[model samples]
Target chain A: MIENAFYSQEKHGPYKLFSLGNFELEEGGIIPDCKLAYATHGKLNEKKDNVIIVPTWFSGTSKDYESYIGKGRALDPDEYFIIVINQIGNGLSSSPHNSLPPVSMQSFPKVRIGDDVRAQHRLVTELFGVQEVALVVGGSMGAQQTYEWAVRYPEMVKRAAPIAGTAKNTIHDFLFTQTLIDAITSDPGWNLGEYRSNAEVADGLKRHADIWAVMGFCPEFFNQEKWGLFGVESAEELVEGFLEPFFQMMDPNALLAMAWKWQRGDVSRLADGNLAEALGRIQAKVFVMPIDTDMFFPPTDCEREQQMIPNSELKVIHSLAGHFGLFGGEGPSYHGQIDEHLKALLAVPVSESIVEQ
Target chain B: MIENAFYSQEKHGPYKLFSLGNFELEEGGIIPDCKLAYATHGKLNEKKDNVIIVPTWFSGTSKDYESYIGKGRALDPDEYFIIVINQIGNGLSSSPHNSLPPVSMQSFPKVRIGDDVRAQHRLVTELFGVQEVALVVGGSMGAQQTYEWAVRYPEMVKRAAPIAGTAKNTIHDFLFTQTLIDAITSDPGWNLGEYRSNAEVADGLKRHADIWAVMGFCPEFFNQEKWGLFGVESAEELVEGFLEPFFQMMDPNALLAMAWKWQRGDVSRLADGNLAEALGRIQAKVFVMPIDTDMFFPPTDCEREQQMIPNSELKVIHSLAGHFGLFGGEGPSYHGQIDEHLKALLAVPVSESIVEQ
Candidate 1:
């Protein structure tokens, strides 16, 4: 593994390249020169047992998640070795945009939540020599990774919090993610993801943002004109000023890659299509936190998954902003509520919460 | 007015053209040689007071609505002169696809619910001499027309039933319509509304269908897999077999124009931005029927408009199918409920329901 200094970390995140040579994917295909980008805060103790893993969500990066950690925060770096790993295809890592010519752009190999979890496991165990995870918590696609970690390595993950996401992607969500993919690919500017610049596919990117405008934010959010909370006077300004530009900055292929992974996120595959059996494998004290108004992953869907877990509780999050509340777009109240739940989850002694083999 | 015999009516609808010569659009520009396509059932009574108008919805034609008018139905053709008018830009009329070269395709004049109502007004009075309409009832974009007819000519429409749609489009609903527009226009094949064939824009139409697959159907509907009731084995079949093929058959330009009108639906302009005052002008006995789980026009949004209309009653339609329940997608129960409300609304004595002029 070729480890390097955290580059974008100075201004963006504490992101470092942990090269994995040629990494295999859950879907058929190999990612050449595969490296997982991650950011770390605080130092590992002598025992290397105080580590917390937070995988990044779709279109999210390690640097973007820095706001989630600080002194006295639930993910406080003061007493724990906190790591935020950027999932594959999320721009910062060995993504479609940055990969070598043989496996570049639209030709990039498909990724899965299992593949991301496998890569993240290698980084935590091999690089840091960590034997146990104190906590694994994340939201949306990140929450997807959290579930994978708990199910795949039940003994390793002591406690897990999967917020605003589902253990198994529903038919509705699967189709919704497909729309995101279709939005980009349908654009002539995308040119099948061969466009020289992101600007080339601005039309497709804008359409992609439009879908998010409708589904990412809750109806109550738009009905109540909560876009004003984001400091935008009108909904058009929010879509044009905020959502469009944010999506435009990213690569079309990268977004498509991540969307495919999200659509296929289902731990049920581990138990041969039995979701209940798959969730029962989780030994961690899991808090399945779903945003109350999340249009993508509603509380009802998350509750079904939580009921299957051995030691899990359904924690419904309050946020009119819906799915985007994972980004704290609705302000302190969204994060404040998340921190409270995480704080409570982290405070519980792991030894007592976990089940013994 | 150059009135023509019903053409597609044999296999499709009793569609006859009513020429409006040169119709002015509310959004500027005039459609030269504009005509509205309509179908009629039963006959106009000598009193011309038994007339009922049912407007075609977005992407819907008068033919598709033939199911709503039958023996013993709420819209019983046996007793009433039922006119199902295809709204402007709805393809069957003087839409972008069929308009003259100067104002064809991309250059087609923008349409509004008011413009459609105006044309319908001309047809009812000048053609059929309908002095007082027994009722003006429809759903979705059709509901927009229903509101327009009631507010624009209150005395002409004695009863109005707007189902699964709002009188004034909410900011939330406005943005949702924008997504439908973005989905099509983003396609390279759309080529700025000059696609040689609908097949060229298959990708965009499929994406458009994908959005409907997500938002048009409620989460509860998907969670329970009510799609099975549609006779489809899987959700994928429903989207590909039903939605994709259905949308692909329509001209993208026509769909876009209707979406623009649907997004701008609001009666507040009539009362200088006072929605309450605008709706208050409605003298028709109104039954504001919104589907309980409609994601596009939630019952709450419809309830607000219902409260403003003097004789309006909020009749929430029960259907987990959401906005598309207007089409009776959830089966006989959906239509059964809608028919029940319409039956009750039609049976009410208009003298007692209407206010004195």
Candidate 2:
């Protein structure tokens, strides 16, 4: 079995796993015994009306958002029950790293954002007995799932906040995702997804990190040496301390699987390749938050799609951190804005028709 | 010996090579014999006063600028004697693929923008007996050399246009270049710069191409399926027909050499890391042209440095093609703007001090 040190609760947790047996995917793939790891905070009220779902971003586990949750933050565990779910292929969940023979590494089936949303729907509706989600919010790939949840089950998600991601994977996003995957697969030691250790593909991981350094943040983030805030003095140190080592410990196949899903993130396929028609299905109150400096999903790109959703509003987050700003790393400047928006969103009463049910 | 099909004059030329014996690099590297492949158009005036030097961009040879040259275009070879020189390591020049053992592939020394300008300086002054250049112009890595020429030998370059590149490689540019190098190096078949054939590291080249897709152009370029203009229907076709196949023909070690030079493109290093002081040394009338939508060299980024150069003006090229706009690929829309501007610049009378010579 692949080592669990990278994903176990001991390393990055205070989370639990919920076994999702025989999970079927939209793209015609099946995992004999699938599982989703998640973490929750606060209580599910008698009405099951105060539950908020937060999905993890690419390569992130449920616990990665611990700082964003709690008493007075955006998720605000004190006011609402927050469920942070780990998307499949992220090591903590049903990933290639942990699955058995037929479903492991090279044999892992392709998982789509829709498939992840479908599995999370079961966990919320069946296990938690939640009739409606107060909000579904996330960033990057997590934001992809948020859009998926909103369109895939319009009634279940009362409100949605998809940050730094779009309803469909733009061709540019697909290209970026492909490069990330190629970075890993090109590693000779990758051995067609049967690498024995992460060390074997260190060069690939480093390359992947270097790509992130280019696209993950705005040019100002590096030009201004903003990594200095993290106590790293130089660009080389920023890569060494943060990017390189961060990906080095993770499974390359797991990342490739997530990238595959990310590249194919298009809800329009559900509505027969019509983006406007697919977005037309979203009945929930929506907030499309895009980082102003994000290379892949710039504010203009997000605002264009946001205009297609009837009840959606475009909120441009001016951030030097670029896409990574959604993780709240620069400071409370962004998180504070998110908290203010979410508080206002939560303050609005739910529709009486749904509440009566 | 490596095949020269890609660089041979018979295939893509009307060019010649000038060999310099035992050329020594400023950065402590030596090429036993350095050769620069270049092409010239039109006739040299009696005074040799109408000469324009155009350096090739990264991965580009002298012939690649064919579309942008000619009687009525930007360089306007008929009006001005234009010499397009290939940057070292770009197959046509003294590259890893064509050099003999000691300076081939794994043994090729790192080349810099300063070194390229220095070689071109010799070609003009020593070989052509040209005391002063009418203009020094280029884009991308070529643009980097444009800046280098203006600063290093300001007296030689009367005017300069550095398009789609900056005087210093921003941390973002460095990171992007690093990723490109890493992608090629990590390919198992690369065997530490000793690949047998281009097919050996095809995966790496494909990944490099994918990264270019993400950064080389604006999202609008791909979103509108602009590749369709090139007779390609889908993104996959764009990659297969254009990107992948384009890089597959080039030498990986040659690319790595260029990338190393690109990453270290900082004229500021000459002034003890004083960007303003370094840019202040330019005596040439400068036009810093950056593509409005370029991810790596946005107008804001270019404009910042442009402000530091005393005789400089910032020209933002508004094209959806982004950085590729410098290549004049989005039709006459961009090329027209370049022509209009270059015509105006050339119309200015030469400095009396230089004209008297």
Candidate 3:
């Protein structure tokens, strides 16, 4: 696979690159020279009191979070140091798509959500000389990571904002993700991971897109606005309008790896295998903002999580854009909710001293 | 394709053979010695005012509606005469699967919802000597056929109940149906429509199941039950639980043909000159029941149709079973709603004048 520039100082950084120099993953695997792509904006104040961390979503990179980092928005670089880390298995980070030899499906690693959190921890504490993070904010798979940070290291994370995400994978979400993986794996051109040339699994990719298009919106949205569902005049337009963006720039293997991570995300599997206990460990001031129309991460699921953890508040984003509402723009226009939450978090006073154990 | 026993019943007295003889389709398509594999349990009443028509869902045989045609149910054999017509393209129903020189994908006829209703009309008006249907009821695609009966030949259908169905095809439904067709056609073993002797496309069949499993139920159903999302141990169970039945008995060609009909099932398109005027032509008393939790046919879609029709009632069947709640067996079951509606329809005083029009 061709390497794309994931971060540019002009756009995303003065960044730091961390390499494990061949480290062993928890799930009985080794990634030689395993690299974690990341970027940071603004300076870490004395005592690192104003440091904020935000992880990336599935197939999302550190750069994707840039819009939420800069200016007067949430985690404003001018007010607090913000760390954005590329998720493992995504293109810019270490993943099966770009990994050397042993490239078959069998060689793919089975890292869990805990592993992602652990890896991020190493990058923060060991490499960056950071001991505590004031807040961790994320959405979707990123939210999974934020939850992990709070639960896994209650002493380190003081506050968290997990937006439009879930504590565990829902079967409905899993089925959709699994179908996309199956579509890629079943393609004849997939060659069981033994293709000799640059063969693309066109049909499988298109089939994957077909699954995404249906679940991405409510039936009401399509009925109200028929023009956007599939394309008009010809099916080609429909295919182009929906499927092209997903497939044109995506690496099939990277997609599969992320899907595996998503399916394997089970924070409940930790904390003596009791999920609720693990959530209860979080000392952070928690804010769970689940998108109302996000079929994948419905508000009820978020509300359930909020009810489980102490000092947690549930913010329901009433929007019709479904899962993608977290990436606010003209369609969902969720800037108001995002802005309000950021203001509250910034305004709240931090505790002067940590309670000594 | 193995001969499906469900479609092996006799039609028009003597076992209807596959040669083009006893019946012909309205599309001008000829299937020599065409046979409709159907079953009937109820005896014709003395006045035949107790006749009830139940159409089959997608890929379903006349056998599907058998449970409701027993001795004590609404369509009891001792009281009402029931006609459960085997839809065309269902393997055993004069379909492409078992026909002589079996029809290839390219040669398969394009069947409209109207075609299925017209064929059943022939059986009702000619063989059974029934001038008007006491009640026409069905679910999902079956509901589509019931709606067509009332819309196409209103005078013949006295009352209609279309459950968990839509008046016009939505983009989401069209896309999903299209994916199913694509799964069958794109299978390498398909061999351009001549792979009958080779291995059936198991992968493709599995893909078809993957496409359907999500739409059949809600996220809560899967989450609360701890069903596997994917790659988890429960995935196999989940897949089998949802998809196996649909694929095990379905013929690839027949599946494709039926899917095409589903995709093109837009009654609005029938109004070549004027849309509103067409819906205004219907004379049958209509009841549109949309499953409250159905992702495929949201109740609001049915509400639009209810609003448009001159005389109609919109009912909601609330259940977490999603799209399949129309067939759900337990609490809030459609069976009770159906029974109540049947009683109401039977109670309506029929005007003595036959040719009021």
Q: Is candidate 1 or 3 superior in DockQ?
A: 1
Docking class of 2: medium
Candidate 2 lDDT, A1-357, residue by residue in tens: 467478888887888888888999887879878998899998898999989999989988887787678787767777789999999999988988799978987899999999899899999988999978999998889889999998888877889999889889888888888788878787778889888887898877877877887888888898777885556778788888888898998899889999999989888977999999989888788999898889888777788889999888887887878887866776678788887777777776666434322
DockQ (0 to 1) for model 2: 0.72
Tell me the deviation in Å of residue A287 in model 2: 0.6
Which candidate gets the maximum DockQ versus the true structure?
2
lDDT of 2 by residue, B32-147 (tens): 88999999998789999899999999888888788888777768767788999999998888999899978887889888898898899999888889988889889999889999
Q: Chain A structural similarity (TM-score) per candidate?
A: 0.94, 0.97, 0.88
Candidate 3, residues A176-199, lDDT tens digits: the string is 778778877777776664443223
List iRMS for all predictions. 1.4, 1.2, 2.0
Better of 1 and 3 by TM-score: 1
What C-alpha lDDT values do all the predictions have? 0.85, 0.84, 0.70
Model 3 chain B weakest lDDT span, ten residues long: B11-20
- Put down candidate 1 lDDT per residue, B190-210, tens digits, no spaces: 889887777788887888888
DockQ-best of 2 and 3: 2
DockQ of each: 0.66, 0.72, 0.57
Candidate 1 lDDT over A214-289, as tens digits, reads 8888777877888776778888799889899888877788788899999999999888989899899888899999
